[model samples]
Target: MQIPFIDLKTQYETYKEEINKEVLNVLSSTQFIMGPQVTKLEENLAKYTGAKYAFACSSGTDSLLLALMAIDVQPGDEIITTPFTFIATAETIALLKAKPVFVDIDEATYNIDPKLIEAKITPKTKAIMPVSLYGQTADMDAINAIAKKHNLVVIEDACQSFGAEYKGKKSCNLSTIGCTSFFPSKPLGCYGDGGAVFCNDDALGAKLKSLLNHGQGKRYEHKYIGINGRLDALQAAILNVKMNHFEAECKKRIEVGSRYSKLLEGANVITPTIMSDRNSMYAQYSIRVKNREAMIQKLNDAGVPTAVHYPIPLHLQEALSYLGYKKGDFPISEQIGTEIMSLPMSPFLTESQQDFIVNAIKA
Candidate 1:
């Protein structure tokens, strides 16, 4: 009676034939590293997302790192971001020895509050890295305006919102630089770690390509200090297969997410909020409840699994303690950290499974 949290297996079964074929092709070709599929996948992704260029990378974390490195994020530079997100959001900033300035999130969307961003900006600020958390984008129009005024770069940490749109624009295309993950659990995932950087600027695009491939302007020429962030051929092959069905899957994700909101209506829990100008990918159908521990236990007992997207705000984390932030610094992120719980979410979730999960919540 136990239900899977992500249901990746069900999705795999649906595309079994195509996925197997692609894997076998990659295996047989033995072009495991940067095979033909890598370029093909990048081209497919660029066309799909409407980005001028797409640079495939090793992982989502590397995608963010590459974006930062491409823009020359030096030590002592400051980057503003939400504290409620996964550690990778801030960890990348710290890894470059840059300070990740914390900003509070909006209560309704669980995203960085643009109204609070301007107050945090200073001369040392290099970029405003806003995360499109929980498969929805932050207020990019406002965020972009702020970044433009200060002449700072805007990096959309869209790792969780690959299929999402904001103000009629795709997530990765909504900022100066956008990054996404192709981790198997993401909305559009590969069999293993893979990610891409999306950008419209030609110079930055060229720089990103070189940065991901050990700064190779050509085969052996080192241009900038870069990392081993290339996306290999096998993952590219798997993603190419997935690309054929991604649009349909995104539609199904919306259907299932909408159904969940309807079913959970007046269930005394706060459901996700999608703004009018954009649509979410619903990477997580998370709900807010006052009794989180009790609710998680009840759901698990009913054979329904639940998870917290995050348990601690980044500013309050011990690893980031040297930033000199405390418990009350980001109250909204801290409060939501305690209450937000993700339910089973996937394009393939059936109505009956949703009904069962809702019943468990009501009980």
Candidate 2:
């Protein structure tokens, strides 16, 4: 039966009429760059995430960069983050000539261990950037407490967790500044590369807005150095349509994730463990298996496609080798790097397809 991972085509079909109308509207307006759609999307995003303001940007990486720039992260400054996350989290810090201090992750949640953050704090520590890995937020209360004690900023990499919640609050609004992606496969996505920065502080929000538009306090006036990071009006128009159904989609994702856990209860793999106070969007529905290579081969032979969220931890990547990290630096992250595998996950996945995938795994 050939199962697919992330059935975006099916989702597209479901929203085809609305999506087409939005796209056509943008095309007809010809105000493609930061037009009315972008403003409307930013307002909707801010309201959805409970943030006071939102700044739309070109991509998630740029969103992070804009957040850091707003907080005035200077060269040689240190920012604590997990090594198990996507490279963009650390790459943005490095791009500013700042140092990314690697912290080990919790084995169960696959998030940066908040307990270990204190030991890493130095006078040079400027901020704490925690990634909401796999659609669940990190322990924000504890991380914020630590940041408060140190007088450091906190930036949440909410790229995979746009609709998720932490302690009854939305993920992106849980910290000082939140950055999220609108990639085609994200929980809330646009047709092309798109992202946004969210913050409750009005002053910081204005700074983020200025930073996203070539550091312009006004048109043609560059105040601080910035990048060309404006989200296209077309992408914003597409996302506006997607946002209308985001809540329902999130509910469906939770239901599908719960079913996967129930079906795989007796299986030899370790399913995700969500915290009691938070709800995950189930971006990937990943699992940890003892023999991942064999399991992937078996799943492939059975026509049940699988994928790995990350094969290498960021600390060990060649690009960041100059950070002087070794394999044993983050034991938990290194261990999970070799064992984690993602299953076919999407809000549109059917029960029959899930049954087939689970039966193949059990075999």
Candidate 3:
């Protein structure tokens, strides 16, 4: 039997009729830009995430850029973030002509180690962006307290963690600004590229809205330089429909993740950890294993598909050569970069399929 890494087709099959109807409604209305659908989605996401404001944007990358723009990131300013994440997290900071200070990650959560954050702070530091990697919320309470002491902004890159929670608070609401993705495979996904930024601060929210739409405070009135980063009404409508089933999907993902952890117990793999204070949405069921490349080959030969979330940390990537980072700068991140591999994961994943994957790894 063959198994796909992320079976969006199964999920689509289950929600096809409703999704089609919603798409047809958008087509019929012909309000394809930021229309009623986008407004409704923004409202629903704000309520769901417990954030006072939400602005849907073009993509997860755009969400990070918009957050930086909302905060008026200045050139030569520094933003401290984890190196063990998608390049977008750090790339956005560099795009603004700001510096991205790389920090190591906790071996357990694959998140920025807050204990190491204070030493990295400087007068040039403007913000701290901690990514909620692999659908788990990072230690935001600690991160926030540190930011407060240093008087810095905190942006949560919740790209893979839409429904995740930490200490009774949701991921997006835990930071000064929270950004999430709706890429087709995320917990709350749409058909195409889409994302949102969440915040409780009103003035900042207003500025974010302005920054997303050519700096408009009113109709066609430009106030500052901005980019066209608006979310399409079609993606909004799809996300609204998906949001209707999001809670159920999250529950299913939890069940699948739990089973994987239990079955892989005491095997040659290090299971993903669910910290005592947080809940993960399990966007990708990644595990640390020895000889990850060989194991992937073994699993693939047995028809079990696998992937690596990231093979290279940003500090060591060619894109960030100017950062002056070498291979040994962030050892933990570099180690994780080599050992981590993602198994096939989705809310629609079946137990038999998981069993097959596990057995293949054992074999």
Evaluated against the true structure, the overall lDDT of model 2 is 0.94
Give lDDT tens digits, candidate 3, residues 1-363: 868899899998999999999999999999999989999999999999899999999999999999999899999999999999999999999999999999999999999999999999999999999999999998999999999999999999999999999998888899899999999989899889999999999999999998889989898899878889999999999899889998999899999999999999879889998999899999999999879989988888899989899889999989999999998999999998999999999998898999999888777
The lDDT per prediction is 0.93, 0.94, 0.93
Expressed as tens digits, the lDDT of each residue in 1-363 for candidate 2 is: 957798989999999999999999999999999979999998998899889988899999999999999999999999999999899999999999999999999998999999999999999999999999999999999999999999999999999999999988998999999999999888888878999999999889878888888889989998878889999998999899988999999999999999999999999999999999998998889999989999999999999989998889999999999999998989999999999999999999999999999999999
Q: Model 2 segments beyond 4 Å from truth? A: none
RMSD of 1: 0.8
What candidate 3 gets wrong by more than 4 Å, as runs, is none
Please estimate how well model 3 matches the true structure, expressed as its whole-model Cα lDDT.
0.93
Q: List the residue pairs that clash in candidate 3.
A: none
C-alpha lDDT of residue 16 in model 3 = 93
Q: Can you list the residue pairs that collide in candidate 2?
A: none
